[model samples]
Structures are given as structure tokens and as C-alpha cells.
Target chain A: MAAQLKGARVALEVDNVTKRFGGLTALDHVSFKVYEGEILGLIGPNGAGKTTMFNVITGVYKPEEGRVIYYGEDITGLKPHVIARKGIARTHQVVKPFNELTVLENAMIGALFGTRHGQITEEEARSIAMEILEFVGLAEKAEEPAKVLNIQEKKRLELARALAEEPRLLLLDEVLAGLNPTEVAHMLDLLRKIRREKGVTMIMIEHVMHAVMNLADRIVVLHFGRKLAEGTPEEVARNPEVIAAYLGDPELALKFVRRLGGV
Target chain B: MNDTIRKLYTRPSALIAWGLVLIFVVVGVLFKAGLVSLNTATIAMDLMVNIGLALSLAIIMSYAGYVSFGHAVFYGLGGFLTGYIVYNAVQTAYTANPQNFNLTFGRALGWWLEGAVLGALASAALAGTVGAAVLRLRGAFFAIATIGLDYAVLYLVKLYHNPLSGSADIPVTQLGAIEGFFYKTYVLVTVFFIVTVIVAYLARVSKFGYGLSAIREDEDAAEVLGVDTTRYKVYAFILSAVLTSLWGSITVWRQNSFGVDIMFSLRESVHMIAMNVIGGLGSFLGPTLGGMVYYALYRATLTKLANSQFIVVGIIVILFISLLPEGLVGLVKLVRPKLRKYID
Candidate 1:
């Protein structure tokens, strides 16, 4: 698995990115690389800079130090819309749907202004949005206002909106945080299908251990705004530092390692 | 291009806009035929001005969700700039040969048109520069910043004195030298009203409009989703400013004078906002209808209650806000859900 990842082209590279808010460092010199067509799981304890990392990469918060490279081009400190137009798209952890707009309209906004914006007409964008809604299983609710969607449905809508951008790299922030086991399994399957069909590289920030472990091609564990461990799920699951920082129990860590090895 | 035209024609908002312009055209024809009284024609022109102002305000307020409490600054700029240019031109022509100077109808109209064009350009320049700074502030801060913009421009004009007017007040009354000056201005105002409605309709249904609504809903989310929030806001502001300024130019013609105290009145901004709120906050039809309804209510109550006419308008605005926040458009949507898509 490691050898195959090495052979693949690098899709995104974060080099020594440091982000500080006032005197507090949210992401302290964090560095990581995501390979093409892979789902890289970003897992960490609460306040371990996961969402901050997403913000930095998406251009919401400019990092105090270091650069973000996407397909060999430096994109650090560019405006969010500029980054988005460069084929990078993301979903927020707390779902931010255009509440008053119809679900279809919400998705249509992504295509209307996203990566291929102005290249496609409104009619073309409508069809693309519809196709994405269908893919995310929100086709039936397309005409309904996005505010009416339940949490699980809103998550799907978020995913659908991001996918409508036709991004080369997709970042998903805590998409499975509030879902039940069945919904998680469903979302995991959809994510797999997205990668398989669209061949888009994805970086997922997930706290759901089982889903992340089962779905991610590799795992990077963070602790207190620093990288604690980086390896295959099985390797990360067995690492002492990752277990100490994340699970905090040898027995629980051992059980997770067994579950990963068994899978 | 053909499909886009077809879509624009079928749009309910566009239809509403065209309908309003058609009503004004019919009124103009009636006046031309001598079937309507001059007083009624004048009233219809005033109605057009009211609606035109609301529609201009709607571009930024309703569509872009930026409440400009100082929008009257542009209106004042339009009036004063036009006043300045017209006054200077007439003065120059008069001074060149005082006894023989005769301001013809065509010459007077040409001067006013020149002033309107220049005023619009100035308003655009102001909005483009000021919007870049103030639009960065959102919500109530943005609203407050605009009020500051209003005061800053008002004071700047005052401190500079009337370099063009050659006095504190500009007397465009000399333009009354032309026969039927009011009638010509009424015609100009009507044409501009139609232009404003077309602009408001186009801004609502375009890709630009979608980006604006997205920004209104969630600025950060909009930015992240690839809407250039700053550029769109500034564009909308400039459009709003230019239209309002043109109205201001015509206003100087209608009033026959320009006074600093009256031209930049904060009440004008408040009235525009009240009209928008009563019509429906973001719908294209709302402001157009709101302006008419508000004017009717004001006219009806003014004759009976006199000074309390504003009290009546105030009560209606409150009722609309409390009972139907979506205004007249919301009521229509509730009555016919199927018409919702067609309406906006």
C-alpha cells in the first residue's frame, strides 16, 4: 500500500504550514502530502487543528508561515473564490446551506460560480446540479428548500454541492460527525463511488473512527496541533504515540488495531 | 443567446417590470391625447419617480442584502451635479451676451442630459471607490458606514461651496424660460423609470444576481463556493448609485431648484427603505408595487389626516413587518404557491 502511494503523483502538498490566532497556534508547522485519487483521512482530538487546517487550505484563514501546493502550483494566501476556481472545493463541518434557496438552486450555485463558472450556461449548470443531486440521493428533494433538510440529508446536500463544483481535489470537513451507523455506511459507500467514478482526490476530516479507518487509503493523526502519526490505518492504529494521543488506552488501541488488521 | 432572450421574456419578474413600464406608457399616451388632466399626468410622473427610486435601492438592498442608509448621497450628487452643470452652462451662455441669450427647449434638454450623464459617471466613481472600503463591513456595521458616507459627501459639498452655482442654492428656474419644461422633464423621468425597471429585472435573473443572492445568504460560504463577493457587491452598488443619481438630476428639473439642506435629506433614504420593506425584501416585483402602494397610501391619507399622513405610512410599514415580513410578494406567494417561481 505504501509502495503504491509512493508511485502515484502527489495531488496536494502542505509544507510546514503554521497558523496562529492571536498568541495561540492552531496549526503548528503541520506538513502532509495527499496522493492522487486517494481519500486521505485527517483525524485528531477536538481542538487539534483539523478544521483550522481545512480553513487554511481553503483560503479562509491565511497561514502565518509556509505554503500550500496543489499539483505543483503554489496557492497559499489566494482568495477563497480564486482557489475554488482553481478546482479546489470543500464542505463545511457545520453545514452552511443557502437556507431559503431550493435544494436544486443550492447545488446550482456551485456550478454557476464554481470551477467551470461562466464556461457553462445556467441550463447546463442546472443539469449538472441535477446529476450531482441524483448522485448524492437528494434528487427527490431537489425542489424543497434546503433549510427543511434533516441533518443526514443536509450532509448529503453539502457533499452534493461540493461535487457540483467539479473539483480536482475535494475537502470534506466532519461529514460523518452527526450521522448514525447506517447513514455513515451509506456516506462511506457514496464517497467510494465518488472516487471510483469521478477519480477526484479527497481529504476528509472525520472523527468517526470506524468509518475513517474503513474508508481512508491512509490516516494522519494529529495531537495538539502537531502530527502525531502518519501511516496506513493498521500502522497508525498500532502506533504507541497515536494511541496515547487519540484513544488514550492501550486495550482500546489494541482492539482497534485488531479490527483494522482483520479488515 | 436566443434561449437567454426567451428565458428573459418568460420570466415573471421581467413581465412585472414590463407591465409597470407599459402602465407609464399608457399614461403618457393619455396625456398626449389630452384625455388626462395635466395634474393627473404630473401625479403619474411622480409615481414613476417613486418606483424608480425603490427599484434602484432594490439592486443593492434587496438583491445584494446591503442596507444602504446613505443612498440619498448619490441622489443628492445627481441633483447637485446636474444643478451645477446646468447653472454654469446657462450662466456662461447668458454672460456671453446677456440681452440676446435665449435658452431653447432643445438646448435646455441637452444641458440637462449632459448633467445627468456626468452625474451618473461621478456616482459610479464614488460607489466603486467607497464600496471597496465600506462593503468589507457587513450587517449593521455596513449600514452605519453608509450613513457616514452620506454625511461625508454632504459636508464635502458644503465646504467646497457652489463653485458652479455661484451661490449656496442653484436656481434651475431659468430653465422654465422654455415652454412646457415640466412636461419634457416628465417624459424624461418616465423613460428613465423604464430603464431602471429593466436594469432591476436583469440584475435579479442573471448569473450575477445568483452570485449576489448567494452572498446575501452566506458571505463566507459564497466566497468559498467561488463568488467574488467584493466585486459583485461593488458592481451592484455602482449600478444602484448611477440610477439613483440620474433620478436626482431629473429631480432638480422637477423642483426647479437645488438646496443642500433638502437634497441630501436622510428621510429620503428611510423612505426608500420603507418602500422596499413594504413591497417584499428581495423580490423584483416587491419594490415596484411597494412604491405605488406606499404613494397611494400617502396621497390618500395626506388629504384627510394632513400632517399625520406619515403616521399612517408608519403604521402600515409596521403591520407589514410584523404580519408579513415578506411584504406584498409573500402574500401573493401564500395565495398561489404555483406562481412563486413565475413571480421571481
Candidate 2:
């Protein structure tokens, strides 16, 4: 089913991206492409540089070697806000909702200044913020302080905030990491709905194979900042390299096999 | 209407608090008009300076999340500049002869205003320049850097005192007889109070204000949300310094004197922090309310005990930190929901 969508145009292209921190090479010659209107899954174990890849793509950390070309423009070392203004926004692994602000106000911030356009009127921003909150199923808690939100709600708030920016490309960083089984299912449905209804391209970093295998059109596997495999979710799942890279852990491989049950 | 009033009082108790402030002002005016010889009028005026100082600290500590123990650097510099201006004006008048030592408010208004404005500008420049370097360091490093800067300024001023201009404690008996001098000081305080309110209001409503609050809450989150945390933090520091400098100029004018010890004292910085903490960090009216209460307590009871005031203040601060971390404004907020419950 996922292989049928392989012809989608490239939305983001990373060519030979490398990042070094002090004496350690965090990312080494990483390369991949995210297709337009498709859910791309980026996966790796702890310290495999999955988050660093997201950081590099979102302009948080500049890659020492290589270019991040977004929609045919080289956005190699732009600031985060500039990147956001250029139609890319991201959420943190640890949800970073502005605790002091109400949920509505937090979303309103994204609506007000996400793009480099003229100042938005207060009423318009409020309406848009409220609409985003409603879309994310947080309208009832619009006026509530963000600090009081539970973990799932906080993650949802982060998503709502990113969505409020009206980004062409939305990056989800471990958003489903801490969610329970039912919550994870709901989030997967929400992601699918967002992609279907909003026509927004997404890049999600996940450790959960089942969710990623179910949602992602393509999977890019990373190990120690280097791309190990890139293909359709089924191709990556069946790759011998991915299985060996999971430390030949039969339980993990079995989980991936079960997730791809009939695929 | 009930909710409206409740919300108004919740954030901006200053509006209601001003009613009590106005009544006090009226009573003070009456006292000045010969109803009483209350020497404590000066104390009340000094409290306004404290308010300005506390507001400055609140912006730095509460809004920007940069705890500065070196705000006195700007305050002391403002005082010194103000004193230098007055000294120069008096010298020019003395050189012309006629033995007119009496510096009337009207005669000195131009130079006085110039001095106050220049003092604030210079302090802001200093803060911006130093903040560019110091604000790069966070937490305790930032605090210590500011303290070190304060001491450096104090030492330099101490070594460079002017003999012809007289000592810092020079009696202002000559200026005392000048009509409207005290009135000018009062007006300056009023201006500062208005400025503080306006700044606090902007901090509550503006995009930059939200950026500051976001930074305070979570810097990394704010950055990812498209807020330029470094730029906003620098702006906050500079603005806070400028306000503190203006208050410092007013303090010098009110006392008609300045000295290394008085200007550079860490006690002033600590008092400013205490006022902000005890008022309510990040709340709009927290610092002002805290300043008024702190001043009232100091004037009414603690100051009479001289050195023991420090002990009393320490205890009060400890009590606030331990019992009510949100300070007076926080305490009011805690009581408010209960009050609403009762009313409902």
C-alpha cells in the first residue's frame, strides 16, 4: 500500500549532511529525501542521531558538511524562526508548551508571527488559534493554563502550535514516545487525518515500529548519524541490515514482522 | 461584570491600589500644607524610588529570567551623573559672583532634566554593552558578573572624587530654601511611576512581552517557537537598566547628595530583588505592591531599629520564600479563588 505512493515529488532534499560536536561526529554524510504530501518515517535507536537529523533539517544545528535543500532552495544554516517562516515547523521530544501562557495564547503566538508576513490582527490570530485548538480537540481547554495539561495533551498542544504556523512541512520528533497504546492509536489516526485533510507533508521520528510502519509511506533508517537504509516501509522492514542493526534482537524483529502482518 | 472586576483586580490590582495611593497623596499634601510637620514625607517619596528599582529588577528577574545583583551599578552611576550636573551648575553660578548659592528649581530645570535624561541614556548604553557580554552567561554566573561590574564602578568613582565639588554628604541647606525643589522631586517620582506602569503594561500585552515570558518559561521552546531569545533578553536588560537609572537620578535629586557607599551599595540591589520576589514574580502589579508594602514596613517599624532592619527584612524575605513563593500578589491570587467560591 505504501509503495504505491513512491512517485510523490521530493519536498525536502538533504545531500551529504554531516554534523560534528567537539571531537565526536554526530552526523556523518547523511542523505535522504522527503516526498511531498507523504509521511516519511525517520527511525533509529538511542544515540543513532535521529533527533540530530531532525535538528539539522529544522535549522537548529548546522551540518558541517552538506546542504539542506527545501523545495529547490538551499536552506543550509538558516535560523529556526527563518526556517519556520519558510514553511517548516517542528515539535520537541519533550513537549515545550509555554507553561505560563494559556493553551489559546500559546497557539496564538504561532498564528501571530510564524511567517515573515505583516502583523496579524488580534481577532484574526485569536480565531485562527481557537480553530487550531478545536481541530486538535483542545477547544474545551482553550482558556486553561498549559502547565496543567497532561503529557498527551501537552504533545497535542505542541502539534496544534506547529499546525497553527500553517507550515508546508511539519516535523514530529518523538511525539508518540510517551503515549499509551490507546493514545498512540488516536495520535496515528490524527496524523493520518492531518495528512489527508490538510495536504501537509510530515517527517516523524519514532522508536515505535508498529505506528511508523502503519503510517509512513517511506522509512529512512539511521545508525550513528549515517543513513543505513532508505526505501518503502516494507523494504526497510525486510532489509537484513535493519535486522542486524537492531542487534539481531529477535523480539524487536518479531515486533516489526507482526506490525507488517499482511503488508 | 463580576468576572470582569475579578479579572481586572487579579492582574492589575494597581488600579484599585492607586485609590489608596491617591488618598495617601492627598493626606501628604495636607500634611505639607501645615496640618503636620511629618518629616516622614521624604520617606514616602523615597518609596517611589524603591518602586522604580523593584520594577526594574522584576523585569530582569521575573520576565527575562536573568537575576541581576548589579542593578546598583546603573543606579549609582545615575546618581553620580546627576550630582556632577548639579555640581557644575552651582560652580557656574558661583563663578558669576553675587553670592547667589540658592539654586532655584526653575533656574536648574534645564540642567536637571538634561542630567536625568543623560544619566538614563548612559546607564542604558552601559547595560547594553555589558549585557551583550554578561547575558551570555546564565544563572549564577550572570548574577556574579553584574555584582562584579557594580563593585568596579564603585571603586572607580571612589578614586575619582572631586574635591572642589565637595563631598557626597554636602548639606543641601542652600537648595532647601529654593521654592518647588521638593515639588519637582515629587513630580519626577510621579513620572517614574507612570513609566513603570506603562512598561509593565507593555510587557503584559506585546509580542516581545510574550517572547520574554516564553523565554522565562522555557528558552529552548521559545527559540523553536520563532522567538529570538537572545535579542529579547538584551532588550529587557537594557530597558530595565534605563528605568533603574531614571529612579537613581530621582533619588539623588531628592536627597541632594550622592556617595560611593550609598550609590554602589549591594543592599539596594538586594532590596530591589526582595521587593520583586515579595510582590510576585512575572505578575504585572507584583513589584509595585511589594515595593509599597516593603517600604511601609521599613518606615513604620524596621528602620527605627537601624541595623536590626536587616535582620527583620531577612526574616520577612525568608517567610515569603518559604510560605508564599508567589509573594503578596501570589497570596492575593490564592485567596481570590476562595473569595470567589464564597461569593458564588
Candidate 3:
């Protein structure tokens, strides 16, 4: 990835963010900083509030306590579109594509209105969308209806649409969750390339440790809506608490360790 | 095949459509020539009114994924408002005991045109107001709210039977020349048709249209993508309502009166839904095609076999939903590709 940190500043700063849904606390005083041009992996077991954290960051759900500061501005509780305009974009856990619209048309919407008062000619938006599609290896499927895409392709299209917005901070929720090995490898390469080419900061909520460990500069783990650990991939993998948590599933932990390859 | 023929044959159904319109025009012209005093032209006019209703429904159904059964309320209100204005104008003109309510070319043109304009404005206002409240509901709730509104309006119209201001029938002593009256009605219908076409076109092309389609496809996703769902829904409802009201006003003008029976009838609501479905809900040309076909069938078959007309219509609607959910246009799309392969 390109390390051209021109005007390199904090891309996102979440100061004690908390979210509660009825009786269940989805997030509890979560705090993190995403540096410009860095990939941050957020991982936890199921019901660990990883997706909820993403929702709060992307303005889908407002944090009950604390603020979400993006690029030095307090953007807490802004509508999703308003936050999107401020250069924060996100993909959903369950891929949501406009089914009736062609893939290109869906991406075009992102390019046209992604930023606040940002206007681009239709031709320009189309070219940008096409380029993003190529980056995601979906150039061939640009004219097809988004509904007809396979799961992997739909996930890629969601990412491509977010990229079209030229977001400085991109929040990706479980993008590699359902992908096959080859598809997962391709997505990892694409994320690396995106960070290199666009200098976009990304916070990825991932279940696949191998995919995220290799990509994220820093890794944060959560359990029951509270921060469990935050450190380099090597430190996190060796943490006794993390190992005990994964001990119940010996197969997954063994596989993760093997994939880490002596890290 | 040359470009024109290739384009024409590419859409075989469209070609058949043009052929049908041509046949209707020929029949209308022949009837006007006195070979037949066929009431088909009047029926065709009514079909055009139904087309307007279907077109409005299409905006909600196809574009917004909202199904409304109470659109008849707007249609009836439109007709009633138009009837109220034109009838009052005629009464004003004849109170001085003019020989005929019909004005000469020089005077009648301006007065009739003014009445048409006023009627359109009134209908549009009412539609916008009602659309605001009713559009907030979705799914069955939205549909029921609209139906409730329709019944409410029907009862309100029923309650008022005053001869001068609120009654269903307002007789005009001096209705201008027959030629001028028919000509004005034709103009109003044409204007409403053009407006419907323009609204459909805009909805198909504009950002607002895309937003509406996105909402229809997935509301939560659209919101996450920064689309304001509520605002777009209201806009779609108002625009659809205005077009429907324009059609309603013209219907009232044609009858020179309005009543609860005509405005809020359940049959009228069914006609609107049927027109949209038979035409191809959501497709731009669906409502128009459905309206024309249904009207023709109603005139040719229903008029002769009055009771069975509805049964036949019911059967056709059932077939459309079960056999061809995409409606007539969908059927054409299925056939055209196969036919082209054979030709090739």
C-alpha cells in the first residue's frame, strides 16, 4: 500500500461510543482511532456487537453515549446521508443492492450524491463507477441487474458502490463472511489495492481471522459489546483471554494459528 | 431489415399496439363521418380517463411499491370540482335568460378555458393535501387508509343535496354549441393524457425517480445510502394524485354534473386498478394499453352482455396476475426474443 500520508491526520476518532437496543447493550463505551491510510480490523464472536458498532459509526444507529468524530469534526447522530456526505461510507452485513437497477446505475447513485453538494457530470460518474467495478473485478457484470449477482459479487458491488463515494473512512461489515477461499483472497488484494491507490482508510468488521489479520494494521476484539483487546495481530493472537475464548472451538483456533504461520 | 422496421419488429407487441390504435382511429373517424353513430368514441374517452387513473396508480405500484385502493377518491373529487366550476359558470351565463348557455366562438372559448384551468387547480390542491396524510402509511395500512378516505368523501358528498351549491346534479340552461363543448372536452382529455406521459417520463429518468425505485426495492438500504424515503414518498403521492385529479375534472365536465354515485363508486376504483394491471403495472405504457383494451372490451362485449362484462374482466385480471404477473408487456417481452431467434 502507498504510504503517501499527505495531510495525514486522524481519519476517525470514536470517543467512548455506546449503543443500547432495549434491554441489550449493543456497544459499551467503545473507543478507537483509525489513522489515515490504515486498515483496522474489528473482530468478535457472534453477538459481540461488531455489526452494531459499525451501524453506530456509519450513522445507521446513534450511539446512546459519546461522540463519533470524523476528520476532526463531531458527526454524532447525523443522518446516514449527512455522514456519507462528510466522507464516511459503509457496506451492510447483509448486502443491500437496488435489485431493479442495473449494477452501473446503482453505483452511479453513489458517485452523484455521495458528498455534500458534490456534483459530477453523468459521464464522469459512469467512468468512476466503471473504474471501481473493474477494481472489484465486476466490470463484466456492470450492465446486469444487481439482484442477479451471486453473493460474492453482490458483496463486491456493495464495496464498489461505497468506494465510488470517494469516502475517506470506509466501514465494511462482514464483506468476506460468505466468500469462498478464492473470492476471499481476491477481496483481500482489492482492499490492499484500494488503500494503495485511493489512500482510503477502512474499518472492517470481519469473522475470518486470516483475511483481516493480514490486512489490518491494528486489530480490536470485542465480547458482549465491550472491548476485549486491542493490539498488533501477533499480540492479539497470543493473548490468553482470546485463546481461552476460542478454546471452546478448538478447530477454528487451530486453523487460525496455522494460517498465521508462526506469527 | 432497416433501422425503422428492425426497431418496430424488435417490439412486436408495440407494433400490435400501434395497429390497434390505428384501427380505433379509423373507426372513430368513420363514425364521425356518419356511417355509424357508434357510442364507441364516448367509451374511448372514458377509457382515456381510466388510463389517467391507472397511470397514477402505476407511480405508487411500480415505482414506489405502494398499492392503493382508494385512488378513486381523488378521481371523484376531481370530477366533482370540475363539475362544480363549469356548471356554476353555465348557470351564471344563463341567469340573464340568454337563449342558449352556449356562447359563440368569440366568448365561449375564453370562459370554458378559464373554467377548465380553475377545476384542474382545485383538484390538484385536494389531491396534494390528502396524499400528504395517506402516503405516510405503507402496505395494507396505506391501502386501507386510502379506502377509508374514499368512503369518507363519498359520505360527505352524499350528505350535501343542496340544489345550488352542494348537490350532485346542477342543470345548466345554456350549454354552449355542441361542437365547442365536445372540442373543449377533447382538449381537456388530451391535456391530462400529455401530463400523465410527462410525469411518467420524468419519474423514469430523474434522480427523484431513482430514489423512489430504491425505496421500493429496499427502504432501509436506501436510507443507509442517504435517500430520504419519507420525502420522496410524499412527492410521488402528490404527483400521482394531481394527474388523477386532472382526469377526474374532465370526466365531470363531460357529464356536466357530479354525484356520489359517479365520483366515489367502487366500480370506478376497480376500473382504475384493472387498467393499471392489464396495461402492465410499473411500465410506462402499461396503464394506457390496459385502459384502451378494457374500454374496448367493455363496449363491445359488456354493453351487450351487461352482467357478464364484470365476470369476464374479473377472469382476465385473474389470468393476468397468475399467468402473466408482469402483465401484457411482460408477455410481449417473453415472445419477442424467441421470435427473433427463429427469424435469425
Candidate 4:
């Protein structure tokens, strides 16, 4: 994973972006480039503007300053669906499934929309949806109502839906949240497979440290609505500022860094 | 050949829906042909009209997931407009021969049919214009807005005291034999009901219908998934209004009178909601089943309590909402899970 997609062309770029919600600034002058086919981990403490950054990239929020460039095309202030149709897919932190519909139908919606084949017929969408569900190991549960699925299954359903779009860039928001240890390990393995086999560029926001450190080739840390640090996961784990962002006390920051295997 | 036909049976709900439609048409035709009593035909016509009305309202509400409390606005508008058109035709006859009392009942069906068409068109146009604005609000807000709209139309029509205007509430002249009137109305409403079923099923199985269901589930999420939620909703509203208006046109044609009170009454709207709710919201057979039960209630007891009839309707709807929120169809599916595929 580290050797592959090294020095690849930029798939997505956020240059000098700032987002403000009335009195509070959610993201200020945040900039990063996600290389094509690379797993980019975005780690931050609570209220560190991590999800807000995902919203901006996914077109749910338009930055007050700076532009979002995808493959050299400047896409600023476009509607979320428009951006989605241009091959960007995202999962919500809280999984949302169409409760009345079957899992297949839920996935079929993603395949039918938010992609180049936005005008495809329902039959065409079904084939694509089934293929995605099969890949996500949810083919057996295709006929069941989405609401019948538990939380972990719902999370996988969300991933399958996002995958159904066959997005060029996938924004995964806390895919590992609330999972048991085995579920987390299973998800981490799936992420590795997604990177290796699917080759979809990913930007994952996760509080689960090992999952991010294991899956991401490079990690970016956000703190107080700004890009605090950026490097390989090993380098980021050793950064004093990144440690301080995690734990405010300077002494605690040093202890945390040492615990992370920093000298 | 069998595979081709089997392909059409993809949704069991649609197949069952068409089956029910065929049964109604056959029974309706048999009655018209005197194979059954006139009493049966009248009951069938009433059921067909209510089914059409409930299906239209429920389909829109189900897809959009909003209860339209003022559905009778379209029904009333369609009825009054058709009545006015039919009245104008009779007035011309009276002017030509003041002594004869407009005996153009044979020609009157044509004029009535024309009026029905225009009435449906007018109602749908209103929905398009109003839905664009009112449909923006969701849930209770949309319901309240539609109620306000129904009353506003009613009051505005009431202000017109001119005999030529819609507010005058003119009693339509008798045209042709009573049998002819019954046949024309029965056939006319039957055609509309058939068209309503076709449209409802098409909307359910098509890509557009899928978009609507997505919107019903979660509007914001649907938008993120690339659904043009606003456009789908407005189109559903327009289609629903057009179908309901056709039934309204049939209502005035049967009653032989039109007024704001009779046509645009809030009580009428409440009845429509009750029928749809009792049947099932969003289910293919829900509206049909609901309309039948509702008309049956009218025949069984509501007719006795004419003034306070809505109290019974109110109670029945409340009971259904509490005990069987998905209505009869939902209960059926729960009892026989194997039948869920064919019915739900």
C-alpha cells in the first residue's frame, strides 16, 4: 500500500479553503492533496472540523474562500448531487438506509444515481447493485429490509452503497466507529482489500488509531479548524504538535508520543 | 412468450392491482348490461369513484410521505368547473327554445365529457402552480398549507353571487333518461379509474418512482444520492391532482348540482384522507381496499348519522392509525409473509 500509488497525480485538491458557520469558523485555510489510489487518513479530536472538511469536499458545504479542484477541474459551490454525479461518494457518520426498501434496492439507488450512468434503467442498476453487494459480502441479505440489519451490517451496507456508485473518490467517515474488536479488525481488512483490489482513492476519518495507522499510507491531522500536521502515519504519530492536539498538556503530549513509539 | 409475460409480473403488487381493476371493470360492465341490479351498479360506481380519489391522494402522499389534508380542493374544483361547463351548454339550449327545457340530453353527454376534461386540466394546473410553492414545506406544514389553500378557494368562490359564476351553486338540468346518465357517468369514472391504476403502478415501478421512495425515506440523503427530489415531488403532486379532479368532475355530474359547500368542503377532504389512511399509504392495493371499506361504512352507518358522520370516520381512522398504521395490506403481509411479495 505504501509503495503503490506513490507520487501519483493529485486526484483531489483543496487549496486555501476556509469554512465559517456564523460565529465559528469550522475550517480555516485548510489545504491538502489526495494522490490517486492512496488511502489518506484524516485524524482529529472531537470538534476538530474533520467531518466539516468531509462536508466541504463532498459539496454539502461550500468554502468561503479557495476552490476544490478534482483532476484539475475547479468545482466550487456545486450542489452535493452534482458533485456526487461527477464520481464522488460519501458515507454519513450515522448510517442512513431506506428502511422500507430492501438492501438491494437501497444499493440500486446509489448505482442509478451519483455516477455517469445517472439515466440508467432500474434493471441496469439492479445488476450493478447486486455486483456491489456481492463484493461487500451482503449478497445473501439483498432481499431483506434495510431496517432489519444491525449497526455493523448497516455500516457495511453504507459502504456497499457508496461502492455501488463506483466513485472515483470515496470519502469514508468513521467506517470503524462503534464496532467490536473483531468487527474493527474485519473492517480494517476490508479497507486493505478496498485499497489493493478496488483501487478507489479514499479519505477516511477515524478515531480508531490502529485502523487509520494500518490502512493509511499518509495521515493528516486537523486541530482547531486548521491543518495541524501532515506526514506518513509514523511521522505524524511522532509530531509534538499532533500529540499536543490530542492531549493539551505538554507533559501528557510527550507521554502520548512515547506511547505511540516516538523517541 | 411466457418469459416475456413473466417479465411484466416483476412486481406482484402491480399484477394484483391490475387484477383488481379488471374485476371492477367486469362487474361494472355486467351491471351496466343488466346482468346485475341497478342497485349494484350504483354501488359499484360509488366505489370506483372513491377508489380513484383515494388512490390519487395516497400515491402522492405515500411517495412524498406527506399527508395532504386538503385533497378535496381538487375534487371540489373539478366538480364545480364541470358543472359550470355543463350548465352553460343547457343555458344555450334554453335560449334557443324556452318552452322545451333543454332536452339535448343526448348531446349533453358530449358537453359534460368536455367539461370533465377541462376540469381535470384546471385542477392539475392549479397543483403545478401551487405545489411548486407549498410542496416546499414538509410533513405538518404542507398539510396545513393545503388546508389553507382549500379554504381560500372555497371562500373566494363563495364571494361570487353571480348566477353565471362558480359560487352560484346552480342545479344542473335533467338531461336524457336516468339510465343514460348512469351509464355515461359509470363508464366515464371507470375509464378514469383504469387510467389512475395504470399511472400509479407505472410511477411505483419506474425509475421515477424509485426516486420518490428515496425522497420519502430521507430528503436530504436522497439529494446527496443525486435524486432531483424537488422535481419528482412536483410531478407526483400534479399527477395526483389531475386524477382526483377527474373523480370530482364525475361527482358533480352524478349529484346534478355544484356549490362551494358541496364541492370544496373540508369535510370532503377529511373523507378522502380517511379512505387513504384506512386502505394503506404507499401500498398499491391500499387505496382500493381503503375506498371500498370507506364507502361500505357510508352505506352501513354514516348515512344514518349524516351530520355527525365524520365522527365515525374520525374514530375509524384513529383506530387504524394506532393499531394498524400500515392498514389492511400491512396486516395481510404480516399474517402471511409468503404473500408479501405478491401484495406489498
For model 3, what share of native contacts is present?
0.40
Sorted into a CAPRI-style docking class, model 2 comes out as: acceptable
In the predicted model 1, the residue pairs found to clash are: none
Which structure is stronger by lDDT: 3 or 4?
4
Tens digits of per-residue lDDT for model 1, A66-92: 999999999999999999999999999
Q: What is the DockQ of candidate 4?
A: 0.51
Question: For residues A112-216, could you state the per-residue lDDT of candidate 2 as single tens digits?
Answer: 667632456656777989999988889998877798899999999999988888889999999898999999988888888798888899999998888888788
Q: In candidate 2, what are the lDDT values of residues B59-174, reduced to their tens digit?
A: 87877778899999988888878777876777778688757565668767566677788988888898889777899898899999999999988887777775446454323234
How do the predictions measure up, each by TM-score? Answer: 0.96, 0.91, 0.85, 0.92
* DockQ (Cα-based) for each candidate: 0.75, 0.43, 0.37, 0.51
| Each candidate structure's count of clashing pairs | 0, 0, 4, 0
| Model number with the top DockQ | 1
Residue runs of model 2 more than 4 Å from their true location after superposition: A1-9, A116-118, A247-263, B1-14, B17-43, B100-102, B164-173, B337-344
How many clashing residue pairs, candidate 2? 0
Output the lDDT of residue B344, model 2.
Answer: 7
Question: Interface-residue RMSD per candidate?
Answer: 1.3, 5.3, 6.7, 3.6
Looking at candidate 4, what is the lDDT of residue B320?
97
**Alpha-carbon local distance difference test for all models:** 0.88, 0.78, 0.72, 0.80
Worst 10 residues of 3 chain B by lDDT: B1-10
Model 1 chain A worst lDDT window (10 residues): A254-263
- Lowest lDDT 10-residue stretch of candidate 4 chain B: B1-10
Interface RMSD of 2: 5.3
